[model samples]
Target: MIKLMRIDYRLIHGQVAMAWTSAIGANCLLVANDAVSKDSMRITTLKLARPAGCKLVIKSVEDSITALNSGVTDPYNLFIIVESVEDAYRLAKGYRNIRSINFGGAKPQKDCTRKLSVTTPVSERDMQLLKELVNEGIEIEIRQVPGDEKINVSKLL
Candidate 1:
């Protein structure tokens, strides 16, 4: 079962490996990003970045959905990590009863607004899409780690 769902642009950075993992007490890390899933080098880098004794699985959003709903009944706490809000929106498409989503990081890019403390600018469309997602009952919050002061999407919007 997924203990936490994290949306971080830097999927396996130091903060993620050290702070978020420990904060959530996650034993297994599941990264759902198309680029990292397709690239062996990135996946290897992520694995190397993780602390010892942490089990990590890098898979696409589709594969993640399969694994998430497979009913395997994992005893270890699982963390689902994704890059963009769009990816989270995509991953949550068919899934049911998901409550909250965390905005970890979304580094700056041209024309992107600083939607959260850690994220850069996002498009108008993305903002709208995220609002719609929230309206559909998915809670969005901006926080670097579990213990960080969380910023609500409604207030931010």
Candidate 2:
């Protein structure tokens, strides 16, 4: 069971390993990204960065859906880490009951709008999909960590 879905390009960084996960008491991490899942070395590095007791599963979007959703009756807490907004959108589409998406970090890119040092560059299609998700009652917040003050995207709208 995933309590939160965080969209961070950096994946399991210091802030996530030390602060957010600790605060949320997330023992399981399901990283849903095609690129990272394909790269064994990157996955190994990410798993190593996580705390010793925490379990990290690096899988593609489809695989994550299958693994987490199957036989889940008690709703165990887990964290879903994604790389981009598009990936988040896709995951939400593939998975249900997804509300409150967290923006941890996105690399600065051309034509991006900066919010709390994180760059968000939305293409026309991406914006449309995001708007659709918002209309479907998804809450979006920009926060680096649990302690970091949250910036609600709805307020900016």
Estimate, for each residue in 39-125, the C-alpha lDDT of model 1 and write its tens digit.
Answer: 989988998997677898888888877777775526768878898888888777745545778887775766675554546457676
**Model 2 segments more than 4 A misplaced:** 72-75, 111-121
Q: Give the Cα lDDT of each candidate.
A: 0.78, 0.77
Error of 2 at 97 (Å): 1.6
Clashing pairs in 1: 112-121, 113-121, 113-122
Candidate 1 scores a C-alpha RMSD against the true structure in Å of 1.7
* TM-score of candidate 2 on Cα atoms, chains taken together: 0.87
Compute each candidate's TM-score over C-alphas: 0.90, 0.87
lDDT of 1: 0.78
Count of clashes in candidate 1: 3
Task: For residues 1-157, write the lDDT of model 2, one tens digit per residue.
Answer: 6667898888898888878888888888889998999998998899789876887788898887776567452355688899888889888887776788987776555655434343555555556666777888998888877877888766654
The per-residue C-alpha lDDT of model 1 at residue 57 equals: 88
**C-alpha lDDT of residue 52 in model 2:** 66
